[model samples]
Target: MIEIKNLKKVYAGVTVVNVPHLEIKSGESIGLVGNNGAGKTTLFRMILDLIRPESGEVLSNGKNVSGAEEWKNYTASYLDEGFLIDYLTPEEYLYFIGGLHGRNKPQVDEYLASLTEFFNGEILKKGKYIRDLSKGNQCKVGVGACLLQRPQLLMLDEPFANIDPSTQFRLKNILKTENKNLGVTTIVSSHDLNHVTDVCERILLMEKGVIIKDIATSSSTLSELEEYFGVGQTTSTNTGIDNEENH
Candidate 1:
């Protein structure tokens, strides 16, 4: 449901993102994996029109995202604390988000109830504002608000970071359910190879402003990714590069 053509973003003469062309079909789950300074977050910001691209356009359903509002109706993204209204309590923040989607108090309460297991009793009925919560708790509030929208396309950055291990497992299962059961298009950018591979059907490996590999996840995907990252190597002088030719 999304397409990119010659999408390139530059900063101070350095190309941070330079994908020539890419397409994501409806209901596809995509995992984006890369190292630090690999342009992953920059690309996400451009696609969401949070930043202007120096060249090319990102299209959602054939319409340029930067010039169109239709895509926002079905797209939800959470990249960082910048996406949260930290001054509001978790309940208030969630309620505000639900109301934006035309949900009433009762409807929102029901939705919150569904997230009980996901929240693990740490998110609701708290006396603190979202800003007072731990980083991981704030993240939960953000994701909860996004899910309350019942979006068709969802994007998250480093969703596995800063959360407890139990919460990570819960997040992975939630993503899988959203993708497979509800047919939502989910895109996750993370450094955690195993978690991303378990949740996404396809993986995109980006480095130095370029998408170097687009892989369809299979039984060996985790091992292959670890190898590419030099984690599987015995020598410390690894290049963190796969010798296989890029497709």
Candidate 2:
């Protein structure tokens, strides 16, 4: 479980993230939606203790995450390409991450073998470094490494961005399976509304650093979000894609 209490962040006199209270129960698949600068990544950073909030706190299983190390044992996140070691090959990167979590080479190999379809035969046995892979392929490597940890809490930002259509389909299945079978607390932020709605059981919409709407995933959820974003209108706003730079 995760809890946010009066969380706040500021930069150069402007508040980026502010939340009075929020709770994420275990085994929940949540989709965080917002235009760029809506504070999606800022909130995520606070959750992982990557950035210190100006006030309040984020708790993982009742333990404060800020300025603490214990939560790292059960948490994993992939915010961007910076999370990857650019010089290593995909195989090397996965092995290194698995090793950090006590999975030996044989164990890592076994796990990698199971992802052959996800890899699409391009990620493994390729002699190229991660930096050399296309952006979509690199995303695959990074996301794969995160799942290798089997973390209790998993977070991914803009996971569908730059990914091919086929791989995006595969990723949806992978995330749903992991959340359903392993009960991982999965939090994802995405600009792709359809994909996010397909995978997440709940949705949180943010604007100007605050959550304006929080709703369960239902038959009308996608259309509701589309209406809010003005999907078919000429004067459409934000679209949840333009605000990418702010996060």
Candidate 3:
């Protein structure tokens, strides 16, 4: 389980994110949605301990994330290109990350074999560095590496941005299977509403650095969410009218 308490982040004298309390239980898949600069990425970073929050605490299973090295072993995250080792080949990178999680080479190979088709033969035998791979291929390698350990907590930001539609569908199914089979708690952020609605059990709506709405997918539909985002429901009403005219 992950618990966030009074989390806050600021940059250049402007507050970027502030959440009083949020908790995610184990075996749940969550979707975070917001316009650009809505602080979704910042919130994920804080949870991953990649960036420090100005105030508040992020706890994993009751341990403070910042001080919990054990928690790192259980958490796997992929955000952007920065998370990948540009200098290493995909195979080497996967082995390295697996080693960090205390898995041996045989264990890594076993995990890779399970994701055989997802790699499309590009990641396993390619001798080229990850930086040399195409953006889509690089994303595949990053995602594959993150899943190698079958982590307890998985967080991905814009996981489908660069992939083709087929691969996107494959990934969505893979995530769903992992969540159900392994009981991995997952959090995903994406602009694709259909993808989010299909995979997440709970959805969080953000606007200008604050969480304005939290709805269960079981109780709400994506069309209703589109309406919330389309009109003056949470933020400014006139902005919705302007958007409608522009459309």
Candidate 4:
């Protein structure tokens, strides 16, 4: 389980994330939705201990994440290209990450085989470094590396962004399957209400750094989110980093 109590982050005295209390149980797939600057990325960074919180704490399965390394064993995240080793080829990068998780070359190879469709013939053996891949392809590598760890807790920020429409659908199915079969506790932040509602069992609405709504996935959930975001009247492409360009 993941726990948060009075968690907060500030930049120049302006609070970006402030959650009084929040709990995420095991095996739950959660989706976070909000406009740019709503604190989605900030909250994920704090949970991953990539950024130090100004107050309170984040607990992963009863282990405090801040200033600790124990939680990293069971947690994996892909927030941006910064997570990737830009100098290495896709194959090399995956093997390196797998080794850290105690997986050998053969094990990593088998796992990469399973993701062939996700790679869509562009990743493995491409003879290209991570920095050379297109933005969408780089997103694929980062996300694939995270899954290779088979973590207990997986966090992704705007994972669907930059990918083509077909791959987006594949990714949605893959994430849902991983969470269901592997019992991975997944947290994804996206602006696409349709995709988020389709994959997440729970949806969290954030505005100005506070969770304004939390509801189970249902026929009405998407509309509710659209209404809240005032997006029902307009078309929602849920397009790339544009969704959070300011963030």
TM-score result, candidate 2:
0.93
Clashes of each: 0, 1, 0, 0
Which regions of candidate 4 deviate over 4 angstroms?
A: 231-247
In the range 1-247, model 4's lDDT, one tens digit per residue, is 8999999887767777889999999999999988777788888888988888899999988888876787898888998898999999999999999999899999999999999999999898979999999989999999999999988989999999889998999999899998999999999999788999999999998877889888999999987887867854343333232333343
TM-score per candidate? 0.93, 0.93, 0.90, 0.93
lDDT (10s digit) by residue, model 1, range 1-247: 9999999987777777899999999999999988766788888888899989999999999999989999999999988888999889899999999999999999999999988987989999978988899888888888989899999999998888878999999999999999999999999999889899999999999887799899999999999988888964233222323211111
Per-model lDDT: 0.88, 0.88, 0.84, 0.88
lDDT assessment of candidate 4: 0.88
Q: Clash pairs of candidate 3?
A: none
Candidate 3 residue lDDT tens string, 31-61: 9988767788888889988889999999999
lDDT of 1 at 35: 74
**In angstroms, what RMSD does candidate 2 have relative to the true structure?**
2.7
Cα lDDT over the full model 1:
0.88
Q: Per-candidate RMSD vs. true structure?
A: 5.1, 2.7, 4.8, 3.6
